[model samples]
Target: MQGTLNEIDIRSILQLIELGQRTGELFVEAHSGLTNTALAESNRSLLSSGGFGYPSPAPQPDERFWLVFAIDGRIVYAADRSNNNLLRLRDYLRFYQVESALDSTQVPLPSANPLEYACLWGLMENRILTPARARNIIKNTIEETLFDLFNLPQGTFNFEMGPALAPHLTSLEISPLTAKIVKQVQQWKQFYPLIQSPNQCPVVTDRDRLQQILPETTLANLESWADGKTSLRQFSRYFNRELLAVSGAIYPYIQQGWIQMSDGCDGMPTAASEADPFGIAPLLVPSEQEPHQRAPQVVCLDDDTTIGKTVEYMLVPKGYRASALCDPIEALSQLFREPPDLILCDLAMPNLDGYEICAMLRNSKTFRGTPIIILTGKEGFIDRVRARQVGATDYLTKPFGEEELLMLVEKYIGLPEIAPPPVLPSE
Candidate 1:
């Protein structure tokens, strides 16, 4: 069992494929006790927290999404994107048929930003269907496929994304040397805070990977990337020479695992010198785990410190949506337009205090008693009492822990709970 993770092979990869019924490729390499795996769009490493730079645009997938494993710095065995996409589509189809019975046929096929509705289709229209490829597409099934896909978690017998009953792992032996290396990863617990930062991106090196992830593209042009030779950043960008590409364009690619930033390769010097390849990171692959099941949305109303880092970190892992509004005025304006699930307000403001805003929301028929939480540097019972009188649902002092804030949200908003998976034994 110990040796199974040490240096994985294609057999394990194939099992993941067959079980997940995913498509695409899986890559892994091991020397000594270190192991690494790479998940292609088809691979199931989507489960890993910070595994790849890209996720298949197709929403359907093979594994549980969490519990993805890694060998060293690479993916070894993982789910396939194609199969995952197919499963997602199947779910959508089942849902659409169950509720609507094909009567409301708007033709809800998988759609990518640039690819055709039939891009996945292989035939002359009759039976030719392109399989699922990206994670987003599978998730955003024309609003019609949700009937079947959303009901799968019920009735038990859930499918998992690990080994196929450990088919002769060759040697179950684990060495002390390997365990030592695996233990090194434990020190990174501090980085746990960064895991939920959705904006954090991996490096993108492939153009096709970018093309697959982006909203729209004209693949009809750009020849260098056509051969799969150019880096994803190069191929994916349209006149990508713009400076904003890194922040705007490429960042999303990194988020999706189509590419990855250079992580320290094994044995590479951590201390930088003028000689290294400005990057020494591992190639991004699938995350090797499942995505969070549910996340609550958060509306942060603050102007000066408007950045919602805490909210972003708390909700991103669970795939929650968060919106930031620096001005309480703006937050108030947005509520009538579109109400967020939860609201976080500040006690004092330049023009209006958090209490005043809460009162205004309470007056509204739609927002009355909305889960409003207050954050203030000042700590006093009178202030707390005032906030509660104005309809604040929860309150906290400044400088809060992520868990504390998240708990408040879970209690008030009823967003889904998603527990992260346990870290696997390393090395």
Candidate 2:
């Protein structure tokens, strides 16, 4: 129940836990400063138990991530020390378009157990997010976290056996969740050539061109949702479906060039549509006198000068103050001095890549709640899972368009509203 990742593979460890029907938490920590080769060597020890392939060019150390399992050894929840909110639950509710039932300002007290406890409590107390919906959220969250852990390459782990975790919303069998995630990860890899990343926003280039092939219902859904705005990832949330399903639905349109992926904010108000299906003027828009304010600091870390500059360019026009750093080493010091509202980091660098930087920040109390997004050319399955493991809030693929970058930033920290352009009457 206690050993370094070098000693036993995650799959084997999970099997043993399940076999023993263990209940409690498994704590994993990777020592910092281990080179890629050192990491691979350590992981080789893990695979020795059974010959499962380990991640090549292994992850760096400075570890901490946990999996809380039930007596049946089903993973009930997962998190790190820095996680201090029910934001994921909030996000799940919002994604399902049920956030309106709850108030954001009031959050329940912290719990030693899963925040799902607090989340389900709030939803039931207010009679809002719903028990069924809450159960789905918990199940999905735990499965997602387990999927990340299953792909983890190296770390020292300690298992603490104790009574089963309390206030369960739903229980998932480990075997099925594991099997499903494995299949999903493999399937995700297949879509890489056509869909580089889930963050790619699908926009209609020519409606007439698309209308020829797409069904009437499909075309309507595309027009209302695409708008050169929503990312494949966002679409997954809107439909309460998986990322692959959303991407698959639009794949054919992409090939025809009728729909192209663009970088842009979801300018059309989604909240209004979800809230007022009747289509009245937004119930939430501010009056003209309350001029949109500008100013949320954003920090970008990338070795490529162009990428850094491009991020700054995209954010500046949208009323944000952005700073870019090509050196990941220096970026840490800068963040320590002036914490930004959001951070965009690249995965590859000469020293201290995005993963390292993200983990360092996540461990710090100062940056716990701040959003850290990974910007990278690599869209591999393991890469995305690892990004989440280190506390990245989102992942944006390289060569991102202007709107794509802006929309992602807005998703985390909203932008100030600009005045509507003057309407010029036809002469």
Residues 1-427, candidate 1, lDDT per residue (tens digit)? Answer: 2223224332343344444444232322111222222223223434332222233333333332212122222222222222222232332233122212223223323332112122223221232221211222232331111111221231111123343311111111112213332342233233333221112333335667656634333322222222233232221121212112223333444465554544322211122122211112212111223232234467888664534655665666654566667777666778779877688887878788898988988888577536789988788899999888888877988878878877887666544433432332121
What TM-score does each of the candidates earn? Answer: 0.30, 0.48
TM-score of model 1 vs. true structure: 0.30
Q: Model 2 shows how many backbone clashes?
A: 4
* Tens digits of lDDT, candidate 2, 1-427: 5666777966677778877768876655444344545544543343232212222334345443444456556676554322334444555666555665555424344444444455566676575754445555666666656655655677666576766666554555666567787887678777667666665777777889877866666667667767756566555544455666666667767787777887674422343233211122322112323312235688888889888777766777666777888877777998999999899989998869889999999898678668899998987999999999999989999889988888888777655344322332122
The 10-residue segment of model 2 with minimum total lDDT is 276-285
- What lDDT score belongs to each candidate, Candidate 1 first? 0.40, 0.64
Instruction: Enumerate clash totals for all models, in the order shown.
Output: 77, 4
